[model samples]
Target: MSSRLARTSALTVAAVCGSALLVMTAVSASGNTAEEPRLHDIQGKTRISPFAGKQVTDVPGVVTAVRGFGKARGFWLQDPKPDDDPATSEGIFVFTGEKTPDVEAGDSIRISGEVAEFYPGGEEAGGQSVTQLTGAEWKAASKKKAKLPKAVGLGADRVPDAYAPEGKGDEGNIESLKLQPRKFALDLYESLEGMRAGLRNAPVTGPSTEFGELWVTADPGENPTPRGGTLYGAYDQHNGARMKVSSLLPREENHFPKADVGDELRGATTGPLDYDNFGGYTVRATAMGELKDNKLKRERTRKQSKDELSVATYNVENLSPESEPAKFERLSEALVKNLASPDIVALEEVQDDSGPQDDGTVAAGKTLKTLTDAIEKAGGPAYESRQIDPEDNADGGQPGGNIRVAFLYNPDRVDFTDRKGGDATTPVKVGDDGGKPKLSANPGRIEPQEEAWKESRKPLAGEFTFKGRQVFVVANHFSSKGGDQPMEGRFQPPVRESEKQRTAQAKLVNSFAKKVEAIDKDAAVIAAGDFNDFPFSPSLDAIREGGVLTSPMDELPADERYGYVFNGNSQVLDHAVTSPGVGPVKYDIVHINAEFHDQASDHDPSVVRMKP
Candidate 1:
């Protein structure tokens, strides 16, 4: 007999001849069959089980996995006779108490339980609802271990084309959508939730570090980023292409394999699909393959030419005097060794000396001093810093932090043309200086009190002369996307409410750049900082609306454009936009951070070199 037939025959024999297999009791005195139904009847045809709220009985399956120690004590079981439809999953979690289950893997048993939809990490966390069998009672049908089901291979061919549905109404309602397993990846994963699946020869897109999780994509990924991972598109297009591997076994026994980008998980990784608080759908690995590191290295940019000027932008993630001394030391190394010490660097999230202490101290002299001193100690140039401190707690970061944008320039390479110092309330105007655009205040705030900048970091504009050429620089740290919906959230085409403020801020900065061009048509202008939005986003478009400033990142190859990674996708959040007439430019995104476990900052810095 064929293997399929043999398995079918064995299941039939167990069902017909097994002891007490046909017994069923009503959950209450009502004697209602609906109250206690078969596992197949409970599974039904949709993502959620049909008998979800009702008690179920005589649900027969083989034990697949057991989690006896965690806060969520459970074991997963899969039915031998699965329905032909792909939408409904045959496997279901049995929520045992803190006590361990009196069962082992490969044991064919009949269970009496309540069918429930357990939402992990509570409902408010936007966690996925997992259908499970709770308050369960089971009795073994066969002591003889039956052969386990073959692992469902999740190869590239099995991956769906689209990541999620297009419309909003059905985005979070995964249970209601019609399953198109072959067309959409989200649909495919939703169909297979709580089922045994396997990945063969998958590439590790993200390594397990602090979270003990590994993100993998099928080899030769679709919509691959320059760094070998997938790109998160506008409409959550890459959500289905990546999967997180999590192990439920003891940490020592299931130590997550350490591998970087381009590494492969060879052989076979088999696990039961689950949805948790982290990445949406995770595979709790019961078996893992060998991890092979591809030996990825942190790449350094080409050194700046003597005649050319190099500028860089870095978001230090709320750096202050009170921050760990080691963080400052590591950041200095990244600036000197990795970035090669650019002529001018725009810094974001530089906090006051007292850091998050809300005592109304807005000055950051001590904070900047610590950083500049560290850079100089690391063999970098002695950089001079300039910034306008915002009102305490007015900026929307950590309270009392007074986080704002600032500039660090190598005094030996550039000259800060100090015109007039502008305070927090000053409105720096774009004026005509002999037909060249001139800033009324050399280092001034750009519409600091504007409604768009309400409780946000104001853009800092400064003028500098390098190689006898005057260059305009506007350092910006726009309103963050804190209010925006998560990319993996229930909302389809997630709402980015913060984009409005960013757009307004971008228009204001664009106006300054245009004013500079109006003064000197061919003048070099650089606007660089943590934009807090993607290069292709609408906010960035607002900055380039007048065609005065353009993203040099766009000139880079598609794969090399990203300076940030979110949800396993390499994307650009920090950017530099240069004036139209700049020539012979070279841009590099130094990947010193973002990908590593020991990163000093969450963002990677980008450097640009061009003739002024």
Candidate 2:
């Protein structure tokens, strides 16, 4: 027998009730599921279906929604009569391959198909799986219209504060385990998968994207930041109220609202709860709410005091001279106005003059010159640039763009102590310069040859004299989270495969900071740039492991600690950590980008002020 037959044969039926409407069931069962094979029986109480990998006949439900567009087109089938159990959902997605199913809302139907778990990026990818029926064939059981089941209300009250349940072992796959919808948010969403769901007057936490999607908070009170965003404060807290919003309205209608952060989707937005690879559980809205704009504004950081040496970090998003003049102007204005033109600024993703032209050329002098010139044009200080260009395209970013971290400093405020012998392979070492500490090679790479730095931008260390005091600033752009599995992947807890290298990279940067302080205990060392990880992540923990460096954002209020926004959660990715010697530091994650529709760069710049 075939594998499918063998698995089906494993389930022994005690008896058949009738001939035409045959009811086949397992020998030992809790309820007569065969007699009434509703949507709940297929969904069960767990994430994985109880009848997964087996064939089922005459599963009954009402056509609640139909998805006519997209590669996987199908209609949602929801049972009008629900079971007493809240753990099992009454809805199921019947996958009809590429063709849109010939079905409509309020149609009572009976479907027969193979119950299978659809892992978005495959089971091996370690993402959560969606329980769906494939190769489905259905017939309209009722000629008359059937009432569509009420959409499950999703709000702060329903979705539990806990994010997800831990798996059986380290793998964290909660597929087979029973769901506790009242205790865990993931379980709650899983229980309502493919079911009609609605949120009333939802607050938009993430702005609408070009891809016709936005994110909203079911609970507006959950870890809300000052500027209309849900704060992701810790590892355990992923802001359970966050959910993606994708409109089901036809694209030709042009009815989707363009909303910014803090806006409210007024009235009721109802839709089927669907799962995808990008943002996990989403509300594919059949009835979208009207956009109520709050006219949210951007924030600016205060200027540094005369005695304070301000250092800032900004990822210019692969900036090159070839970029639009508007981009350069906007970035310069942001640096000078929003960020208050800090004394030292660490710029990440500064591409070479050729900007993604994959030739042998790797010089970025013209690129830095354009930015410095723009800053001056913007009525800011005449900032000078210092950066060691990587060898060709060794550092990863855009294909031809030799993106590297570069520093821009006002010569009048600080002096860059440029030492020789710094290159892509050469490591910067800490040395004693008289009574103070100094780098053997200024503007040097930190452990560039290490495997952790492979295909990643190396930390650019530079020595500067701020008011006759030796201060060190390290600019970094660690490995990106390209290979990491999605949070809603097949695995219960998504694996961060890219974090290992980042952790190692963080350790190297930490050791460098420690060495500077080791040579002179009171050395002012500021490590700032695109960390590409959260404050609570292992990489950031490793950076602060030995108490050598401390992130200043920790001092800020939990709600005001974020510098970047992703999906809908306003979180931290860029940071500026200082040594203990940099006393009485002031930091601000200047909100100019990330929250707005029109942005200079995807990331917002951060500034830190300290008396060296």
Candidate 3:
């Protein structure tokens, strides 16, 4: 039978379960997963804290069985419990696959799998969702003995090559003497057949490959629309070779391999994929395939989420429009060329309906129109930008262009079935003007200072749809720089009450989160923008308490924090706050290192990949 059939036959019925879903916060391994209590532990056990706060740790276990996905794989196992009752954890398993195996269960003759925590089509289920393995390994076989083949040198000069009996592939890397490919074949016996290679077929389940091998299938980009200046890389032949992409070949079905660690791969890559910048030169893969202890380590990335959305937020600091139609056109050119085209963009310091500012003319409507038009000019779809036009309260540096917020988005992401008005309403006036009879403070409101230098503050809100889901987005820009509230005599040091503005917005966000939650329990709400605070801050604390929202930024590492300064301290104010099973949005520092404020925005732009 073909390798595909062999694998299916083996996984007839699964017999393991565990903490079904975990709020995964790190990469996972399949085989020997166990470091601490892990959100994902394929075939392993741990007693660590079960909160989403465990920044990073490994769950230990042993090789049970490996399963395959299109381009990745997950392993299965029962996490060890306090009473060590294997029967109780039998129905659940941790996942670990793809070459990296550093995990193992009690020795040999063991197995594992992962449970679900939260995902689309999964509402009643909440807790642990096993999607990856952080640790795993194989143990000594308890059986009498296993078979061995003669003359095993796997491959090299005269070691011979593997050949598919059915005659597939150009056979560049497969050895001629090998019988066939076995999923996770490299880790099994050092050698197989006379050629020392296992059949490039399905894995063996109880000596029969009725179940599938831990190998994934990938669909290489058919059109080969390689980027203009990218460099890509991948590994091949059971960690024996590496392939740096010179150019993208047309994407074809079955062109790419789906797998976890240890499974033979075509190669690995990090981009500059198609761009000329990297040329055809060698490329490096930050991570590679290998078996660690016994676990199959794999990267954490769900290309598609339930909502099927990806978001990108930028501080596009000081993006102003030109008064001159001619200069305005040039400014538009810069936006198209530099500002990355993303599904959703939340901007700060953008010129709105107001006039010009000292830095640039980020006037609202026209500025947005120019940006969207520019994007379309450069082979992109048309878009709309929105913001709330409020009175300027600048501290004297030109009050005309002080409102700090704008968002550019793709309407296709929103489901019109549950559409809501995508406009800003809350009036957030700060400072002496007290802004319109004082915008009602959310749950926790703090007094704003008047006897000090302060910038205007406002909250931006928008609504959209994703994956049959309706969601709302609230963006904001609080007072920049520092200030103080004048006391009886001396000035009281400025407290980062910026959180108050955020908290107020947070209340608005909370109101919306509830509004959306009421529509669908799984309804997702995201409040994102530059918060100007670190991961753990009072301002953020207040917002969380007020909005009852979770933040995707919480999953990021401190060193990986966005928005940097010369002193080395990082301020993680930019965020994408979510509700329910919303996100751990894909974010990046988008490093544009420089000393000048204009080099890159004083604040970093954050990008989050939506479920889709």
Candidate 4:
């Protein structure tokens, strides 16, 4: 790695000096060129190394932000898109890197590096499979170059750094599913809250009734695999939760030695980590944070920039608007003030018109509307929202509250197609509980195969066009609590088919892509949303791992890969997978959302961009 690459973080540089199209013969070491290159012939003009190689050239874009993992930091950039998931490179392609920073989201800079692909158990453990932009030597490249391509966009694929293969991206009982409700009603009085670092035994904080609380075996070799032991401090939920942790053992992995015994560890939400001790193992966790009373609370205010948009997501802290319409309105305003309203915002844990008590009120479930109106009233732009009316039968969160997902957008900025309630087949369903399926007369198992469920989560899919490029996006939340078949609790590996959870979801996504292809064989799919799993899980691996869809997130920093942490390890659950012809665009973290979720939601919102 040369000084340019070093200054750019851990990105490897690939060599292809003359691959560029229409470059002047006279070149400088800085590689800064004023002539803009055509993107349609990108394949003929570009070169990328497999790994740890070098690339000699420069692409222009801006650095979005820098997220620190440990020793290395990830540099997420906002590059232009050529076409929606199209490799033709017709427009600016947004790209992100795993190394360091050389640009900002709004900065116009160019970097030339080798692009590589990533696969689970294949290379670099987990990273992008194609165009792993590296060895990036950054400098000012283009300033208002060519017009953006309409169909061009960046890939939206990613890996989970925490809660994975063993319990993510696929179907499994979401222990947190139970805690989804009672956000503020949770009763966790004495457990660790928030991100605690560099310590072994963290003191308990006042309890709150949330869901980060989990169970693990202090002695994996004991008679029962998960015999309860000492309380593992409460650093667990990916977003935030109200948990009850009373037993814990010891762990040799302590990333933050400076983490004290008890200081209400707060920073980016961290751990609920599971460790393997020989054949035996110990389970631990990272608590999002114990409940705290906020008197000086603030919210994220929307800030739009030229040629850029800033969007963030989170399960707002105790802001169940419908639960308490008046209070909800107050919090709604706070949210708009704090979490900036972006061009498009995808959110989960939203309320539907189910009504407070499932009563047959005409407006019983217009939760999204109420909040949307309230947010707009709080000094924001007019936004349109969409969500499934949650099953009235399921006992999720607040009484009759919908555990539905929603996408609110500024229609003036982008175009969205309505696609819901299609009755399309799903590869699998989230287990009744994160346990073994119950025997029934149905052909498909009601419960996710514990073994298979450990891999991934049921995914939600959609597509949106930004500046003319249609990008496919998927939103998901993988399994949170890991356990054996209910009533038959024991640490047991699921049947091989259980791992099929990932395959199932991946197939579903593929099916969706096929549907789009039917509409336009060349249509690019941008699958974006939380996956609830990781890069290596069989679910993600089954996708176009063979030089197909691109995952710009893999090219990002390690710790930054994960939207949230568990027991210390980072997990990337949020993802954006695009069909070919999309991707190679600039990607970056809109970290504003995570700060609001210490007992709020369990995941963060991740977004990607490309110019049309």
Give the better candidate number (1 or 4) by lDDT.
1
* 56-80 per-residue lDDT for model 4 (tens digits): 3555444433332222233433334
Model 3 alpha-carbon miss at residue 329, Å: 9.4
Give lDDT tens digits, candidate 1, residues 1-612. 113212221110111000112111111111145365545566665555667556677778888877666445678888888888776677877877556788877999999876765544333334445667767898999989977766788878888767666432533444445557777776677677777887988887765656667788864557776566766555445546678787765568447787666678888888788766455677778888788877767867777888989999999999999899999999998899899999999999999989999888999999999999999999999999999888878878989999999999999999997777588888898787777677888799998988999999998998888998888888989898876655553444556778999999999999878877877778888899999898778889999997888877777777677766665676778988988866557788898777654578889999988886
lDDT of each: 0.76, 0.83, 0.36, 0.37
Model 2, residue pairs in steric clash: 126-491, 127-489, 127-490, 127-491, 128-489, 128-490
* Model 1 misplaced stretches (Cα beyond 4 Å): 1-34, 38-44, 68-73, 95-128, 134-148, 168-174, 225-227, 233-239, 356-361, 419-421, 486-490, 581-584
In Å, residue 63's CA in model 4 sits off its true spot by: 59
Superposed Cα deviation of residue 528, candidate 1 (Å): 1.0
Q: What is the C-alpha lDDT profile of model 3 across 462-493, one tens digit per residue?
A: 55666544455666565443332111001112
Summarize candidate 2's per-residue lDDT along 1-612 as a digit string, tens digits: 124323442231121100111112221112223333678998898777777776778888899888776556678889888999999998988777658789998999888877766655444456566677777788889899998888888888888888887777666667767889999888889889989998999999988776778899999999898888888787667888899888767766556788888999999999899876567788989899899999998888888989999999999998998899999999999888888899999999999999989987789999999999999999899999999989888999999999999999999999887889899899988888786887889889999999999999999999999898888999999999988877655455777889999999999999999888887899899999999999989999999987899988989988898877787889889999999998878888888988876778989999999886
Error of 3 at 131 (Å): 62
Report model 4's TM-score to 2 decimal places. Answer: 0.43
Q: Work out the TM-score per prediction.
A: 0.86, 0.90, 0.40, 0.43
TM-score of 2: 0.90
Superposition TM-score, candidate 3 onto the true structure: 0.40
Could you give the C-alpha RMSD of every candidate to the true structure, in order shown? 8.7, 7.0, 23.2, 26.7
Candidate ranking under lDDT, highest first, comes to 2, 1, 4, 3
Top model number, lDDT: 2
